[model samples]
Target: MTDGVTAAHGTGGHGEPADAPVSAWVLGADSGGSGLRITLAAVPEGGAPQTVGTVTSTEPVRTGAQGIDAEHMLAQLVPAARELLERAGERAQAAGLRSVCVGAAGMATLGGQLRAELPAALTREFSVRRIALAADAVTAYAGALGQLPGAVVAGGTGLIAMGTDLRNWRRADGWGHLLGDCGSGAWIGQAGLQAAMRAYDGREGGSAALRERAEAVFGAPLSGLPAQLYPRTDRPAVLASFAPEVAACADRDTAASEILRAAAQEIATAAAAVCPAEEGVSVAVTGGLFRIGEPLLAPLREQLHRRAPHAHLTEPAGDPLDGALLIAARLSSDALRLPQDPALLSLT
Candidate 1:
């Protein structure tokens, strides 16, 4: 940890204490389509850390809106995250916090976009060093499986598949909202919208489950959906928010069911691409899409199993924030060691 001078770099309610001991503070951040999440944990060597707390913020990107540039999204999000870290540090100070670690979206892949930009943003706001950044998927992958080599599929506002061979790593399908996020929430919503459009055109002769659900939830008629959905800043949510209703209609409506089935296929394909064809790979599913239950996971698992017979499946042990903290704990001059904390055990 840095001296109080470095810790006192930014202006919040209170600066760092002159006499505070420099301990380990673990912070993880997930800046996804829905919003932003910051988790803080206080870890002492060989000791279990008491939960400090979590700070929730918003992603710079609007849930469903299009046309907003990446720069604009980062501008809005970077400040919120900085404020969150400062806030967490202050809270940890009140509760006794010393070091911090962060796991956030864009941290891993959005290099010029997030890596350099974020560190500068933080330093401008606070005196912080020892920051470790990785793909949000890394946190999820690590959190779900600990140091073991495995693959994780996240189907949320965006879809991304990643895996580590415990040595080598690979990833695919994080195309964002425009090109293709194959197995993402955006994909599901977009597919659902297509189904609705087809139904409206009479090209398809069934009630479009996605369209009906969107109408029910947003109180917006299906006829005017594109107009309402496209012009707004939160298009992803406007579309994805209907996910539950789509799931409900999947069994009863062919169009809706087909959309879900297609999503499962895409996810399975991504999983296969990330994992080796050889047996014994571990795979796990997480994110908002899986929360919808069997409508998604069951089909996805079945498809993956058919492709890779020896793969193992498991539920996420802890959230990605925990994974971020776990990553921080592992980053060392040499190698990371397991802490005595029980809460952290789940992360590994």
Candidate 2:
């Protein structure tokens, strides 16, 4: 129906104008523990693609026998994609709503395991040309550098660093909050609380500002935390909420300063580890922790200088959501080249 052409539709904020008709459309979605985001965009015959609609909502988590739970992602992705197309009225379906590309957490390793369930779950909702899925990390790399080869460090509630030389893919830490995610907001907050509690216990000295922040977060002195934190559900999220206050205390608070510095070093270590030794490799960073640029990035850059003197640090070209959109675009266009191979998925 599209005749190999596409256009965007829907109405309202982040959506297309009510009067415009779209030739074809596709969705790019990014799903994580926090939420799911989808962008509906238009692809045309000989012109650039444009985003016409954006939708976001929380979705149910799906489970599998091996703990590969991409079905949780598809549950949300399917409904959202259908709803957006419906908003475009009968025109969009008639013109051919093409495909959906998902950049999701835990998807990279799932492979055919996730793919096997796609048709039953997604096609039942709407007809599409095809669906392509990859790990959120893959989308981060593709979204950041496009066809250009390099590494990306995405640190938000969690942390992950990945790089590619077009021939080989290199990856560093992203082990989630418990085992790793050294530079993540969750890490920063938890560490800040522990330090403040140590000072409260008279075991160490900490920043007054951080201690105050911790008290505010816990609704009591540091002594009260151990009981609540250990038994609490959603501990990472609860702890991460205090990260901003810790970042705010930076220069004037020694404990805060040290925490930020340590976080910066951890991020730098991951970023540096993934980049190839070869020169001209660019490193881009994305995450909430990096948002407090000076208190964090200044130290990160310095550490990277010492660690990988040649790697260039730069702002992320886009966020994971943007990366997801880029992935959708690439999947629909054969003319667009990607350097990915099976080995990249192996993360060898």
Candidate 3:
């Protein structure tokens, strides 16, 4: 019951007459720790789809005992979808949203509610006939390689590596800050802070530079950092905030340099663990962690060279949002081929 219906008039919004045909539309969404992004695209008959409009929400969807809050997500998603539909003009509303794909962070583990409820909700709102709910990692792979055989490493506040041989998915890490997500932003920041603490304790592996940076960033009496950090809900993001300082000190501090090297090794190892064994398989690294530049990427490149020599490293083609769109477009056309899993990707 979202408004803006124009199908009865039949105008295509391109100066076409009331009898002109309108292209079908699809919706794609990416929801993660940062926020949610929704995109609308037009899929013309026998032609490639093109993005028509997009909307973003800075507030991340909430999670609860049942898992990712389905109703909470809908509260944000419905308004965003409607906004896009309106912005794309009356033709888009008339053609209608036929399919939707959502790629969310934690979908593999916390998507039970989303899987159970989202399809029905979208069907009611947009009359969508098909839906694909996927783990953000899977979408990251699609965005990076576009259905090609490859491995994709997504590193942000957390990290995960995903790959496929066009048959099944293989994943490594992404266990969260406390358990795994090794070499992720949180990992790097935690390592840096540990080095800082070691320096404060006059330990053998201590780095005075890291200690200084930590104290400067976290305030004097670094002992107080624990109280400031541990009680928060956004601990991973809070921890990740210090990663840039670690990279900044890498050139002058042996401990920082070693931390980056170790992190790089861990990231490369994860990528190797999931990378398809076929010769010349592609591997791409995506996310904000790499933005720290040479302090991280240089060592990562070296580690990748050593651990995954047969797999060539490449730049990502797009991002998780783009991956969701690709999935939506393919699902609408009945051409989706990515392996499906109840947890990672469920098609309806």
Candidate 4:
């Protein structure tokens, strides 16, 4: 345990002796799909988190492309992480840093690819001593609940729900756009597009009205979507932005509304599946789709109530950056004791 000061790797490379005494630090990175964001924070002796530096990176690679060459994406992240650390180190020279943690997407569940890559790359450049790599969802959990046994349902291009029993953890979904991601943006947009096509062909089940709207939105019929929507190859990232439109159309179009309602049920089911049916469970809803307000959350809450009647849903207290800082603080203490309220470090 660190009594007052400690030493760790710097932005240059890992495994190197720390140049200065240690204080406490946190670094959080959310990468994958469209862009990456790195946040560096410094926690003074007894003070709250203060921004040290930040960096942003983007990977145009698709999930399909990542499956073939994830290294390409890693290349984009490593440099940004290094940049943030460099700035953090300059600030840390005055305060000292204890630990660094990374909460990145497409890294945790897809094998240890990014896990090993991140450490190796950082070590080659910085002096990071204690480093933790976890799923962005896990980081979101820590940020939203701060070690509590709660779940977070993140709906963007992908939909996933993760929860912890404190000692152990369980995850419900997040199969990606191609496979599942029921209530995700990709799912909504894809469903909308498909309905439009069916309307054009007179083969659509019940999406006639929604189909017409989709055609109006996209100019030509749904068939033109493949090229118009995903012109850059980052199809999921491109398609994800339209999820809100689908939710908007739900009330106006029977087929669209049914699709949205079903999606809510599917997402809530995934969230509930991971949450034990016992009492005193906490749940939070986040992501762009939910930003549309009641059209999403109210339905999702109703669906979750069907199974876990006592589950409580709240807005996320903080974001991934807060989680990174909390994890770093815990590592510095070596007791994993995070702040009682992660929201205390909210970015905004």
Per lDDT, the best of the predicted structures is 3
Model 4 C-alpha lDDT per residue in residues 206-317, reported as the tens digit of each score: 4776666666777765778667865577677666666677777767777777777788898888888877556877888776667767777678788887866778887676
Clashing residue pair totals per candidate (backbone < 3 A):
9, 2, 0, 12
lDDT tens per residue, model 2, 194-267:
77877776676656677777887777767777798779788877778878888888978888888888998898
Whose TM-score is greatest here? 3
Candidate 4 regions with alpha-carbon error over 4 angstroms = 1-23, 45-48, 59-91, 109-113, 120-126, 221-232, 235-242, 337-348
Poorest 10 consecutive residues by lDDT, candidate 3: 5-14
What's the residue-level lDDT of 261 in candidate 2?
Answer: 89
lDDT of 1 by residue, 226-291 (tens): 667779887876667666677788888887777778788888888778875556778888888887
Q: Candidate 4 has what TM-score?
A: 0.76
Candidate ordering by lDDT (highest first): 3, 2, 4, 1
State how far residue 116 of model 4 sits from its true place (Å). Answer: 3.2
lDDT of 4: 0.64
Instruction: For candidate 2, give the lDDT of residue 234.
Output: 83
What local distance difference test score does each model get? Answer: 0.60, 0.70, 0.86, 0.64
